[model samples]
Target: MSDASTPEERLAALDLAVPEVATPVASYVPAVRSGDHVFTSGQLPMRYGELLLTGKVGAQVGLEEAQRCAQQCALNAIAAVRSVIGDLTRVRRVVKVVVFVASTPDFTGQPQVANGASELFGQAFGDAGVHARSAVGVPVLPLDAPVEVELVVEVD
Candidate 1:
């Protein structure tokens, strides 16, 4: 468990900040709340309106860079969730996470890359952040981003 008192504090301890929610490139909203849960759309590894990394993992992008991209995507997902909930403390549990990695056909490190997002959540929310997850390798992602992430969280 994190020593920090709150999710924001834990993220700060990791040298990360919840970035502003990125404008959806399409017609879809960033996130929506239904009942006690919030579901976030796929979030790219964009920082300041630009993709943090491009190309497939095991090609132009490496494993570590892809992992960083996953972390950025998770950060964006958090921002999306907060946009709907207004308060991060309202989160009860991180229900699920889905990570997509653009990678070469032979590449097989998707799970390790997903750990970047998972670890960040664990640090930020402690036990509440532990959740089921899926890591998938894809031919490409929107904007050629190295990674993308989506989240589902139960809220108070």
Candidate 2:
């Protein structure tokens, strides 16, 4: 996969398109490249400029819906990464992913929820996408989004 085609082509193969990087909701930029790494800011499950799901998982939101939301967050993060790096093909590997799920106090399926993002990365990058990850249950998220994801990638 080291010689894989441009990321836009890879995403097109999956019937996906990198979105225009969502406008930042606050003071932070969407991503930054430092040396050999690109760090994406936390990305909400927003599409077409709207939050797709909201509320705490295991409560107002169901596990399945939250999982899907996580996928959208991952896609948004990739868009953010691309905005900074200029091309997904520049990514050498996904180093780490951090997914935050807003949850009821009893919800313990954070890891499963996070797989939504992991699976997408796998589909897009194959072995290069496998990454160290953290799935955390949080009290709430900005815009009341059910999930958010951020990425740390090593780039050429």
Candidate 3:
């Protein structure tokens, strides 16, 4: 029940295998470090450059599945961070998370869906997980993913 683990220890304890970095489909980089902070581009629910699911949340994709997609986005963000810092422990704290959910016009549970990513961060970074976050409903996302997540983290 306790997601308490130092960043490095969490990687080892959870077998936090970092996935391959997702390629950028545009001019933006996956992540960028400035001073003690790293900001990542919005990561879609992708695996190997392919979207895992596409469509509007609460319609073709259920909230549960969208939650899973959000988790995957978190995983992708972690991978991006590791690509730069080489170690998860270098992360000091998750500063912010912006989760965008492609939603049906009437959907209003974006925050709960974004909790998927927020919870993952808590599990992976413990106290460092507390962060400013925004869960916004959008008309669409690139590649039509149900959810996309971007992170801002402070690192050593």
Provide C-alpha RMSD values for all models, in order: 1.2, 1.5, 2.3
lDDT tens digits, residue span 1-156, model 3: 345545546655666545788998789999999999999999988887788899999899999999989988998998899888888878889999999999999999999999999988987888888899999999999988899999999999
Model 1: runs farther than 4 Å from truth?
Answer: 1-4
Q: Please give, for residues 37-147, the per-residue lDDT of candidate 2 as tens digits.
A: 999999999999999978999999998899889988989999999898887878889999999999999999999999999998887777788999999999999999999
Q: Rank all candidate structures by their lDDT, best first, as comma-separated numbers.
A: 1, 2, 3
Candidate with more favorable, higher lDDT: 1 or 2 = 1
How many steric overlaps does candidate 2 have?
A: 0
User: What TM-score does prediction 1 earn?
Assistant: 0.97
Kindly indicate the candidate among 2 and 3 with the higher TM-score. 2
Candidate 3 pairs with clashing backbones: none
Q: Which lDDT tens digits does candidate 1 get at residues 1-156?
A: 444387888898788999999989888999999999999999999899999888999999999998899999999999999999998988999999999999999999999999989998888889999999999999999989889999999999
TM-score of each: 0.97, 0.94, 0.91
lDDT of 1: 0.93
Ranking by TM-score: 1, 2, 3
